[model samples]
Target: MRAVTVRPGAKDSVEVGEVPDPVPADGDLLVDALAVGVCGTDKEIARGEYGTAPPGGERLVLGHESLGRVRQAPPGSGFSAGDLVAGVVRRPDPEPCGACARGEFDMCRNGRYTERGIKELDGYGSEAWRVEAEYAVKLEPHLDRVGVLMEPTTVVAKAWEQVERVGARSWFEPQRVLVTGAGPIGLLATLLGIQRGLEVHVLDRVTEGPKPGLVRDLGATYHAKDIEQVISAVCPDIVIEATGANEPVLASLTGTAPYGVVCLTGVSPSGRRATVDAGAVNREIVLQNDAVVGSVNANLRHYRQAADALAEADPAWLERVITRRVPLERAAEAFREQPDDVKVVIEF
Candidate 1:
């Protein structure tokens, strides 16, 4: 079987080649890969800026945003042979932290958590893969084509969950939300915002693209202007900052309504220095009781939440989010950036 493999820290080393077929362990489900979504993390790993292979191995399977069909399931596992599923990414460290002990490995405190495709595990980028039954979340049958999006959706689901948890600290009833980025994470954040009955506004740099229309079609406003201008005018009660760029992240720090909750989901590159008015940013947050929290990776609960959200979403809209699909043989093409691309997936 062929799988996407990459040598960590070796730039441009990602390639697809024959690998031994997966062998499931006890309580593991053998799945036939259907597709895998390529995102910034995957690109970063491909560029050698991030990622790690299984211990003592040089090549790592390069996928975490996975979608597949179960080919074999253990008896009494509550999963069938044909179920559509997406495997959970993060696994608890062997020396379980308090969080991991409670099934909250996403919040692992010791920084020793292993993640499929990103850490010390072989991911689901192969022709076939095996996952523990408890770590797989079954998807709605109708999501066959768009279920590759489940992982990214889980990200935003966790972000929103973080925002609400932070908001619960006080009298919080947010009416509007500002999502800073029109990429998959941002758009999906917008979708979840709309589902919550909040007015959603998305800001992205591209003035001409499907992004603007995608936002508007979801009954949200789209802005391509300056981040400050959009944030000031919107005065959103909650800001979901999905752009790791300096400007929008800085603006979100001080540009929300009183008692606002800002959830930062994007990962910015280190060593990119930027000037910031630290005093003012601190003063704004302190005076208004604002909260800023960074969220990434999803746990089992979030995966279930994402599954339900995707099931309720419009199939056509979800299909549009996947702007490009490359076959496994041409998997390298999926890494090349396209000007108007949203979410690119490699079909198995």
Candidate 2:
């Protein structure tokens, strides 16, 4: 079997080549790879800025946003051969933390969690892969065309969950939501926000692209103005920050209405210094009773939530989100930026 493999910390080391076929372990499901979504993390790994191979291995399979069809399933696993599934990424550390002990490895406090295609595990970027039955999420059959989006959707699902949990701290009836960035994460965050019956407004730099139309079609407003201007005009009750850029992140910290909950889903690069009015930022949060929480990765519960969310979403709209699909032979091309590309997937 040919798989996408990369040498960790070696720039431009991604290649597709023959690898041994996967063998399922006890309670593991063998899946034939259908597709894998490429995101900033994948690009970072490709660029040698992130990622790690399995212990004592020279290469790591390079995908976490996976989609596949089960080829083999253990009896009583509640999964069958031919089921469309997406594998959960994070695994609890061997020395389980309190969170991981409770099946909340996404909140692992020990920072030793292993993630498929990321930390210390071989990912699902191969022609076929094996995943533990408990970690595989079955998708709706109708999502065959767009289920590659399952992982990213899980990310936003977790973000929304964090936002709601923070909001439950007080009297929270949010009407308006401001999503910063028009990328897949931001857009999907908007979709979830709209599903909650909130008025969604998305802000992105690109003035001419499918993003504006995508937002409009979703019955949400799109803004290409400066972050300050958009945030002031919208006065959103909740802000989902997905840009990972300095400006939008800084503005969102103080840009929401009173008692606002800001859920940050983007991971910004370190060492990018920004000038901030620390006192004022602190004052705003304290005075307004606002909350800012950073969320990343998803657990099993979030994967189920995302599967349901995508199932309920319009298929056409989900299809549009996947702007490009590259075959596995040219998998590296998917990492390159392309204008008008919302989400790029590598098809096996």
CA lDDT of every candidate: 0.96, 0.95
How would you encode candidate 1's per-residue C-alpha lDDT over 211-249 as one tens digit per residue?
999999999999999998999999999999998989999
Off by over 4 Å in 2: none
Give lDDT tens digits, candidate 2, residues 210-307. Answer: 89999999999999999999999999999999989999999999999999999888899999999888999999999999999999999999999999
TM-score of every candidate relative to the true structure: 0.99, 0.99
